[model samples]
Target: MSQETAEPGIEASAKTAEIEALKDTFRNVPGLAGAPMIMAPALAETFATHQHELGVRVHPDLAVKKFIAPFRGPRDAFNPSGDYGAIDTPATPIPVLPNMREYTPHELEVIVGQLRDMGVVNDPEPPRDVAHVVTD
Candidate 1:
Protein backbone atom coordinates (compact mmCIF):
# COMPACT_ATOMS: atom_id res chain seq x y z
CA MET A 1 0.00 0.00 0.00
CA SER A 2 1.16 3.53 -0.81
CA GLN A 3 1.68 5.94 2.07
CA GLU A 4 1.32 9.67 1.97
CA THR A 5 4.37 11.73 2.86
CA ALA A 6 5.22 15.41 3.29
CA GLU A 7 6.19 17.24 0.09
CA PRO A 8 9.95 17.69 -0.26
CA GLY A 9 9.68 21.47 -0.34
CA ILE A 10 7.47 21.51 2.76
CA GLU A 11 9.75 19.07 4.56
CA ALA A 12 12.79 21.16 3.74
CA SER A 13 11.10 24.36 4.88
CA ALA A 14 10.02 22.68 8.12
CA LYS A 15 13.53 21.49 8.78
CA THR A 16 14.85 24.97 8.07
CA ALA A 17 12.38 26.45 10.51
CA GLU A 18 13.38 23.92 13.12
CA ILE A 19 17.04 24.77 12.63
CA GLU A 20 16.35 28.46 12.93
CA ALA A 21 14.38 27.85 16.12
CA LEU A 22 17.25 25.83 17.55
CA LYS A 23 19.68 28.64 16.70
CA ASP A 24 17.41 31.20 18.36
CA THR A 25 17.23 29.03 21.45
CA PHE A 26 21.00 28.69 21.53
CA ARG A 27 21.43 32.43 21.17
CA ASN A 28 19.09 33.06 24.09
CA VAL A 29 21.31 31.03 26.39
CA PRO A 30 23.69 33.09 28.61
CA GLY A 31 26.79 31.53 27.00
CA LEU A 32 27.68 29.62 23.79
CA ALA A 33 28.58 32.75 21.85
CA GLY A 34 30.56 32.03 18.66
CA ALA A 35 29.93 28.33 18.99
CA PRO A 36 30.49 26.59 15.65
CA MET A 37 27.61 24.12 15.89
CA ILE A 38 25.24 26.97 16.77
CA MET A 39 26.42 29.15 13.91
CA ALA A 40 28.98 27.56 11.53
CA PRO A 41 27.80 25.44 8.56
CA ALA A 42 30.16 22.44 8.75
CA LEU A 43 32.18 20.56 11.36
CA ALA A 44 35.44 21.45 9.62
CA GLU A 45 34.54 25.14 9.51
CA THR A 46 33.31 24.97 13.10
CA PHE A 47 36.62 23.53 14.25
CA ALA A 48 38.50 26.23 12.37
CA THR A 49 36.43 29.31 13.25
CA HIS A 50 34.78 28.85 16.66
CA GLN A 51 36.46 30.93 19.39
CA HIS A 52 36.08 30.18 23.04
CA GLU A 53 34.69 33.57 24.09
CA LEU A 54 32.98 32.24 27.19
CA GLY A 55 36.17 32.56 29.20
CA VAL A 56 37.23 29.33 30.94
CA ARG A 57 33.70 28.04 31.39
CA VAL A 58 32.38 25.49 28.88
CA HIS A 59 28.97 23.93 28.42
CA PRO A 60 30.29 20.45 29.15
CA ASP A 61 28.68 18.90 26.07
CA LEU A 62 29.90 17.04 23.00
CA ALA A 63 28.93 19.82 20.63
CA VAL A 64 30.89 22.39 22.66
CA LYS A 65 33.95 20.12 22.91
CA LYS A 66 33.92 19.20 19.22
CA PHE A 67 33.68 22.83 18.19
CA ILE A 68 35.81 24.47 20.89
CA ALA A 69 38.69 21.99 21.10
CA PRO A 70 40.59 23.49 18.18
CA PHE A 71 40.24 27.11 19.26
CA ARG A 72 40.94 26.64 22.95
CA GLY A 73 42.80 29.71 24.19
CA PRO A 74 42.36 33.10 25.79
CA ARG A 75 39.73 35.17 24.00
CA ASP A 76 41.66 38.44 24.32
CA ALA A 77 44.91 37.01 22.94
CA PHE A 78 45.76 38.93 19.79
CA ASN A 79 47.13 37.18 16.75
CA PRO A 80 49.55 39.39 14.79
CA SER A 81 49.11 37.03 11.86
CA GLY A 82 45.34 37.43 11.96
CA ASP A 83 45.64 41.10 11.02
CA TYR A 84 45.31 40.75 7.25
CA GLY A 85 44.88 44.46 6.45
CA ALA A 86 48.56 45.26 7.18
CA ILE A 87 49.80 42.40 4.98
CA ASP A 88 50.78 43.23 1.40
CA THR A 89 50.71 39.66 0.12
CA PRO A 90 47.57 37.57 -0.26
CA ALA A 91 46.51 35.83 2.94
CA THR A 92 47.65 32.24 3.03
CA PRO A 93 45.07 29.97 4.57
CA ILE A 94 46.19 28.32 7.79
CA PRO A 95 46.42 24.60 7.12
CA VAL A 96 43.41 22.76 8.54
CA LEU A 97 45.71 19.85 9.38
CA PRO A 98 46.83 21.78 12.45
CA ASN A 99 43.38 21.30 13.90
CA MET A 100 43.01 17.76 12.61
CA ARG A 101 45.19 15.05 14.14
CA GLU A 102 45.08 11.29 14.36
CA TYR A 103 44.87 9.83 17.88
CA THR A 104 45.85 6.30 18.86
CA PRO A 105 43.45 4.10 20.83
CA HIS A 106 45.19 4.84 24.14
CA GLU A 107 45.29 8.52 23.34
CA LEU A 108 41.59 8.38 22.47
CA GLU A 109 40.89 6.78 25.85
CA VAL A 110 42.75 9.58 27.61
CA ILE A 111 40.83 12.18 25.64
CA VAL A 112 37.55 10.48 26.44
CA GLY A 113 38.54 10.41 30.08
CA GLN A 114 39.30 14.14 30.00
CA LEU A 115 35.97 14.84 28.38
CA ARG A 116 34.32 12.69 30.99
CA ASP A 117 36.00 14.75 33.72
CA MET A 118 34.55 17.86 32.11
CA GLY A 119 31.14 16.18 31.84
CA VAL A 120 31.25 16.45 28.07
CA VAL A 121 31.03 12.80 26.94
CA ASN A 122 29.00 11.55 29.86
CA ASP A 123 26.93 8.39 29.43
CA PRO A 124 28.59 6.99 26.34
CA GLU A 125 26.76 4.19 24.59
CA PRO A 126 27.57 0.63 25.67
CA PRO A 127 30.02 -1.25 23.46
CA ARG A 128 28.35 -3.59 20.99
CA ASP A 129 29.26 -7.26 20.46
CA VAL A 130 31.30 -7.44 17.24
CA ALA A 131 31.91 -11.19 17.40
CA HIS A 132 28.32 -12.18 16.61
CA VAL A 133 27.78 -13.77 13.18
CA VAL A 134 24.93 -12.63 10.95
CA THR A 135 22.43 -15.32 9.86
CA ASP A 136 19.71 -15.13 7.28
Candidate 2:
Protein backbone atom coordinates (compact mmCIF):
# COMPACT_ATOMS: atom_id res chain seq x y z
CA MET A 1 0.00 0.00 0.00
CA SER A 2 1.11 3.53 -0.73
CA GLN A 3 1.60 6.15 2.02
CA GLU A 4 -1.84 7.53 1.26
CA THR A 5 -3.59 4.41 2.58
CA ALA A 6 -2.38 4.98 6.16
CA GLU A 7 -2.77 8.77 6.36
CA PRO A 8 -5.23 10.98 4.50
CA GLY A 9 -6.32 12.06 1.06
CA ILE A 10 -5.85 15.76 2.09
CA GLU A 11 -9.38 16.92 1.28
CA ALA A 12 -11.06 14.44 3.65
CA SER A 13 -9.67 14.86 7.16
CA ALA A 14 -9.67 17.34 10.10
CA LYS A 15 -10.67 17.30 13.80
CA THR A 16 -10.66 19.44 16.97
CA ALA A 17 -9.68 19.08 20.66
CA GLU A 18 -10.00 20.81 24.04
CA ILE A 19 -7.57 23.55 25.03
CA GLU A 20 -7.20 22.50 28.67
CA ALA A 21 -6.73 18.86 27.77
CA LEU A 22 -4.14 19.66 25.16
CA LYS A 23 -2.25 21.92 27.54
CA ASP A 24 -2.36 19.28 30.27
CA THR A 25 -1.13 16.38 28.16
CA PHE A 26 2.00 18.16 26.99
CA ARG A 27 2.64 19.20 30.58
CA ASN A 28 2.68 15.56 31.68
CA VAL A 29 5.06 13.78 29.28
CA PRO A 30 7.74 11.75 31.05
CA GLY A 31 11.13 12.38 29.47
CA LEU A 32 10.13 15.72 28.08
CA ALA A 33 13.54 16.75 26.81
CA GLY A 34 13.13 17.88 23.23
CA ALA A 35 10.57 18.66 20.61
CA PRO A 36 8.93 15.63 19.05
CA MET A 37 7.73 17.91 16.32
CA ILE A 38 8.22 21.50 15.18
CA MET A 39 6.06 23.47 12.79
CA ALA A 40 8.81 25.93 12.04
CA PRO A 41 12.17 24.96 10.57
CA ALA A 42 14.01 27.46 12.72
CA LEU A 43 12.41 26.15 15.92
CA ALA A 44 13.02 22.57 14.88
CA GLU A 45 16.63 23.42 14.15
CA THR A 46 17.02 25.22 17.46
CA PHE A 47 15.54 22.30 19.40
CA ALA A 48 17.54 19.85 17.35
CA THR A 49 20.73 21.59 18.40
CA HIS A 50 19.59 21.73 22.04
CA GLN A 51 18.24 18.22 22.23
CA HIS A 52 18.96 18.02 25.95
CA GLU A 53 16.51 20.73 27.01
CA LEU A 54 13.85 19.51 24.59
CA GLY A 55 14.44 15.76 24.57
CA VAL A 56 12.02 13.29 23.02
CA ARG A 57 9.04 15.57 23.50
CA VAL A 58 6.79 13.94 20.94
CA HIS A 59 6.01 10.38 21.87
CA PRO A 60 3.24 8.68 19.88
CA ASP A 61 0.53 9.96 22.25
CA LEU A 62 2.10 13.37 22.83
CA ALA A 63 2.71 13.72 19.15
CA VAL A 64 -0.98 13.30 18.53
CA LYS A 65 -1.76 15.74 21.32
CA LYS A 66 0.49 18.45 19.96
CA PHE A 67 -1.01 17.89 16.55
CA ILE A 68 -4.52 18.58 17.89
CA ALA A 69 -3.70 21.32 20.40
CA PRO A 70 -3.72 23.99 17.73
CA PHE A 71 -7.31 23.19 16.97
CA ARG A 72 -8.78 23.73 20.40
CA GLY A 73 -11.05 26.76 20.48
CA PRO A 74 -14.26 28.19 19.05
CA ARG A 75 -16.37 26.25 16.59
CA ASP A 76 -15.97 28.76 13.81
CA ALA A 77 -13.50 28.98 10.94
CA PHE A 78 -10.30 30.64 12.06
CA ASN A 79 -6.61 30.05 11.60
CA PRO A 80 -4.69 29.65 14.84
CA SER A 81 -1.35 30.62 13.46
CA GLY A 82 -1.26 32.95 10.53
CA ASP A 83 1.95 31.22 9.55
CA TYR A 84 0.46 27.69 9.47
CA GLY A 85 -3.14 28.50 8.53
CA ALA A 86 -4.91 30.21 5.70
CA ILE A 87 -8.06 32.34 5.19
CA ASP A 88 -10.09 33.35 8.26
CA THR A 89 -11.14 30.74 10.84
CA PRO A 90 -8.83 27.72 11.09
CA ALA A 91 -10.91 25.73 13.55
CA THR A 92 -12.00 23.17 10.97
CA PRO A 93 -8.65 22.55 9.34
CA ILE A 94 -6.65 23.02 12.53
CA PRO A 95 -8.44 20.22 14.35
CA VAL A 96 -7.73 17.68 11.66
CA LEU A 97 -4.33 16.36 12.64
CA PRO A 98 -2.67 14.11 10.09
CA ASN A 99 -5.30 15.16 7.58
CA MET A 100 -5.30 17.32 4.48
CA ARG A 101 -6.72 20.55 3.03
CA GLU A 102 -5.90 23.83 1.29
CA TYR A 103 -2.64 25.02 2.77
CA THR A 104 -0.79 28.17 1.90
CA PRO A 105 2.10 27.83 -0.52
CA HIS A 106 4.64 28.44 2.19
CA GLU A 107 2.93 26.09 4.64
CA LEU A 108 2.66 23.43 1.98
CA GLU A 109 6.29 23.80 0.99
CA VAL A 110 7.56 23.72 4.54
CA ILE A 111 5.28 20.85 5.55
CA VAL A 112 6.20 18.93 2.42
CA GLY A 113 9.85 19.33 3.22
CA GLN A 114 9.27 18.21 6.79
CA LEU A 115 7.17 15.27 5.60
CA ARG A 116 9.99 14.16 3.33
CA ASP A 117 12.50 14.39 6.17
CA MET A 118 10.17 12.53 8.56
CA GLY A 119 9.82 9.59 6.12
CA VAL A 120 6.17 10.51 5.34
CA VAL A 121 4.95 10.45 1.78
CA ASN A 122 3.05 13.14 -0.15
CA ASP A 123 -0.57 12.56 -1.07
CA PRO A 124 -1.21 14.66 -4.16
CA GLU A 125 -4.89 15.48 -3.59
CA PRO A 126 -5.03 15.38 0.18
CA PRO A 127 -8.52 15.69 1.71
CA ARG A 128 -9.27 19.33 2.67
CA ASP A 129 -7.90 19.68 6.20
CA VAL A 130 -7.28 16.06 7.21
CA ALA A 131 -3.57 15.80 6.56
CA HIS A 132 -0.30 16.12 8.44
CA VAL A 133 3.23 14.64 8.36
CA VAL A 134 4.14 12.02 10.92
CA THR A 135 7.22 9.99 11.76
CA ASP A 136 7.19 6.25 11.25
Off by over 4 Å in 2: 1-40, 52-57, 62-64, 68-91, 94-136
Q: What is the C-alpha lDDT profile of model 2 across 1-136, one tens digit per residue?
A: 5554434543333211132222333321333353232234344344334553343333334242232324355432132222222223334364545545667789888988998888796657766876678989
Ten-residue stretch with the least lDDT total in model 1:
62-71
- Per residue, candidate 1 scores C-alpha lDDT tens digits across 4-42 of 999999988865554443333222122345322222234
| The candidate that achieves the highest lDDT relative to the unseen native structure | 1
Tell me the number of clashing residue pairs for each predicted model: 0, 31
lDDT for 87 in candidate 1 is 22
lDDT of 2 at 116: 81
RMSD of each: 19.4, 23.5
TM-score of decoy 1 = 0.23
TM per prediction: 0.23, 0.19
